[model samples]
Target chain A: MTSSTTEPIKITSKEQAEWFLNQYDTFLFDCDGVLWLGTHLLPRTKEILNYLTELGKKLIFVTNNSTKSRLTYTKKFASFGINVTEDQIFTSGYASAVYVRDFLKLQPGKDKIWIFGEAGIGEELATMGFESLGGIDTRLDEPFDATTSPFLQNGLDDDVKCVIAGLDTKVNYHRLAITLQYLRKTESVHFVGTNVDSTFPQKGMILPGAGSMVESIATSSGRRPSYCGKPNANMLNTIISAKNLERSKCCMVGDRLNTDMKFGVEGKLGGTLLVLSGIETEERALEINEAYPRPKYYIDTLGDIFDLTH
Target chain B: MTSSTTEPIKITSKEQAEWFLNQYDTFLFDCDGVLWLGTHLLPRTKEILNYLTELGKKLIFVTNNSTKSRLTYTKKFASFGINVTEDQIFTSGYASAVYVRDFLKLQPGKDKIWIFGEAGIGEELATMGFESLGGIDTRLDEPFDATTSPFLQNGLDDDVKCVIAGLDTKVNYHRLAITLQYLRKTESVHFVGTNVDSTFPQKGMILPGAGSMVESIATSSGRRPSYCGKPNANMLNTIISAKNLERSKCCMVGDRLNTDMKFGVEGKLGGTLLVLSGIETEERALEINEAYPRPKYYIDTLGDIFDLTH
Candidate 1:
């Protein structure tokens, strides 16, 4: 829950929209719902971004999606006719690698990292100069047999220092089996998750997110992962240190209440703006409950910022 | 924690063992850690069962493993030279079917039971004369693509009244995707889990259990399933009603503290006997903690009953 005493202010006038834009020097945007949904860009996304850029507001795209690396996100932005560098993209996959390198401080080559996710997380780890395994390996896709499975019979690598889990679409008994073995191998081996989001809206439906995969491994291993995604203090701190931005000059805009709004509010940023283009509804945002987050401001969409200016 | 105020009593002498046996008319036993570990039976299992039969104590094997049906359990029992009727077995699979049939009371031919588990759950539902889908379906084994997956594109059957989840070693994204869709489709569609044991000791390694699968779906769906296995009131109620047994004259013998001991203690059975032959240790059982269950009685192993008398 956010520590806000007052209800979120709705920006309906041109004056309020201008004041909101002028209030922050840097703006952190959540992708998927705010910038685009699935493949189609949200209404007037390009216009809103151009307006922010023209105002000289530093923009950073922070997404909890751990399925893609920063390079892949750069490609996605290119496909949408938006120009963004890898440095401007902060994905949960990248956050996991940063958390391991900066926070855990595992020795790169000597400490092998095991993954229970797609190639995105592995690619991020590789970018950090760490040797990793168990991501997108066809050998792990084989059917599991309790008695005959090699994962159960053969011991895991002792050099494996950490295990990171995210959205593993190729989730099978074998992958989970080896991951559990590493998690339970020793108390020293670290466990990390990209995010804990239960579900995310994609296309016309809500789909299972990385949280499902992380929770499954956590359950079987009787251990909780150090989540490095949105709302987690580590992610905010990492971005703040890397970008060298002032906390009071940064604002977060997102469509999710728990992850995005909570992330901004808990981090004590300049402000948080909620949009109705994604999972959350206006009614839900207005409710005053300890379990629900209260953003500083609300709008119909990210496009509303520029639209109201006219 | 159990309602008992005192610590568990340890049986050491032949006199104590005989008196403990005389106190109960029936005994409910947990199969995995108590009867056998993998395919190998514990010390003097057959002799102890023979002794119980000679004393005219009704024996029931209650296992939380939903992977095997009653018929499959009968075969496993025969393999161990233990003669037990299908009536004497109460697997979590059978309990799930019982909960759906006797408790939910969904119309047999009209309502469908969607399964996210193995063939055992389907077999149990079939035995109860209910039509079920989505168990051991080879079509579910194919790789998942968000846009191209048939499970995502094709709408689920409206006739689905309930979704039952158990330990599915064949767990994949496609199976979970469909299950999430059904869980979020409508409030009327029920979600049920066979058990919630995080891990089970198997082949000298702790492996993921039904709880892992149940938890993954529960997470993605953002809904909790009504668990029908150990420590759940529904399982004890079903067994009590079906067996026509006296609650004050029955004892539960198990090796795991959470599932087995908690099941017996919370059910308010006459007594519970903890054995060190499985997942629990004497040290863990003896420690006093609010979260830890305290059984009424404990011994080194079930075979101690016959050995002490001799």
Candidate 2:
């Protein structure tokens, strides 16, 4: 049942950091739980990044949270004292837009878009040269607010060729109804979702995320959206191409077993590290092994990486 | 979109009835929605039966409703003025017992059971000459009461080998919790459910059925139950063997598309006629062509069978 050759290690001090050096050529770090949660940075996170840079290791910040764009995440990381460029950040939102652009091969100025997400997703679509029709405040001027309105009452015009879902704070019955209507009318309309996470941690409580909205639309439309995020090959391809890293030399590290561990397994990365700081509990790890891929190393914290010998 | 040829037939009442007599050699009828709903028989039901008998067609009553035994259904049919022998009726409950007996090949006196259904399912198991335990009364101590009493709570011991579900008025959280616990501990414990339907018509309102209970146990146990009903080959085999009818000559007539039409399609019967008097609507008939083995004919009502030939 054990899939790894590396023995489990326990960490105590900074001197053991040499053990993890040169283990991986390209390191993919998850943003939300690994480096920082919301506005606060985890302890020693900056020092670890500085150390990784000093060693000339390749680093890419991969995040499934598509609520914010790369620019937003870049600014947030800079605020936390981790200086990173926009090109170094990859969001599920960016992956989804790139997937749609390449898959459809939309002619310039010919593609019409309908989006149900925040500014982050809109920016990604715009960067890919796709026109976005809706955003956070795009529907505020209508007689009834389409953004917050019920699905049955909202008027989603037929011009919308693609319906993209990322994250929306005002996701309600009206938004769902309009989305469903557009989906039904245009059977060929491409349905794409940023991720399939049911909930995300916010202020110590779990809030409904993109997966819930995807479920509603999928059930009504009898169509499963093409998810572009960790565990999905599209996102992994985007990351590999962007980093110019060989699949055999890259490693994905995260706290969630399904997303993070799956990325390593599906992308054929060198290794996967499951940190116990968030999401995947010990009990969940056992159950997830029944279906999902297992991580190469299980550690109490990301700091435990220091205990491993390259 | 149309799959079948609409050969319009303007037939007299006599020719219409004769067309049915000539076309069908073996008539398999579903009990609940077609023949009688609960206690009341539909109009002209008796005449239809008399006419079919006079035409010398072999008849078999098949039902997925495992709430009642063949004897109970036979008795109910007799009260409705359609005389039928116990051998003429077939139930999924009885078929499930047969499946366990022949397929699993359990030794007659050695098997211990945990049942989660009504009297019919228990009686069927007993008739099959298998040792049975755990009926509605055995679990709840009182009929139709879901609340667990002290006396009933003690019966949920660890030794139970099988969990069978049909329809139990006393099905509740306490019984479900115990059953789930047993299922989890003894992963080898066989779990069987009558069907996966959520609601059934009762007193002019849709009442929760065995499907919800089956779903609860499935969610907790993380195992799909072995089903014995229409669309499942086990039930179809039982009916064909009981009546000694060639599978090719028999026609399964019912209202629902998934269950009734599925039997016709799977069994490769003479014809699958979808009567619009029950579960599936006219719009559904159009969509059904998208699935395998579409229905032979779509009629407004079962009574229209009397108008099939010119």
**Maximum-DockQ candidate:** 1
TM-score, B chain, candidate 1? Answer: 0.97
User: Model 1, A1-310: lDDT tens per residue?
Assistant: 3557898999999999999988999999999889998899998999999889998989999999888999999999999999999999998989999999999999888898999998889888888899998888787888876666665566678899999999988899899988998999998999999999988777787878899989999999989999999989888998999999999999999998889999998899989999999888889888886764788999989998888996
TM-scores vs. true structure, each candidate: 0.95, 0.54
List model 2 lDDT by residue over A156-251, tens digit each. 555567888866655433344456556766678889888877556654434445665565456556567889988788899988887789877777
- Candidate 2 — what's its lDDT? 0.68
User: What lDDT score is found at residue A298 in candidate 1?
Assistant: 94
Which candidate wins on TM-score? 1
| Candidate 2 structure quality by residue, lDDT tens digits, B16-72 | 546545777887887677766677776566776676777787888878788789888
Clashing pairs in 1: none
Residue-by-residue lDDT tens digits, candidate 1, B1-310: 3646788899999999999999999999998778888888999899999999999999999999998999999999999999999999998989999999888998888899989999889999998789998878888888766677665566778899999999999999888888898899998999999999888777787889899989999999889999999989888998999999998899999997788888988898988999998878888888776764888899989999889987
Model 1, position B216: C-alpha lDDT score: 92
* Docking level for model 1: medium
| Stretches > 4 Å off in candidate 1 | A1-3, A146-154, B1-7, B145-154
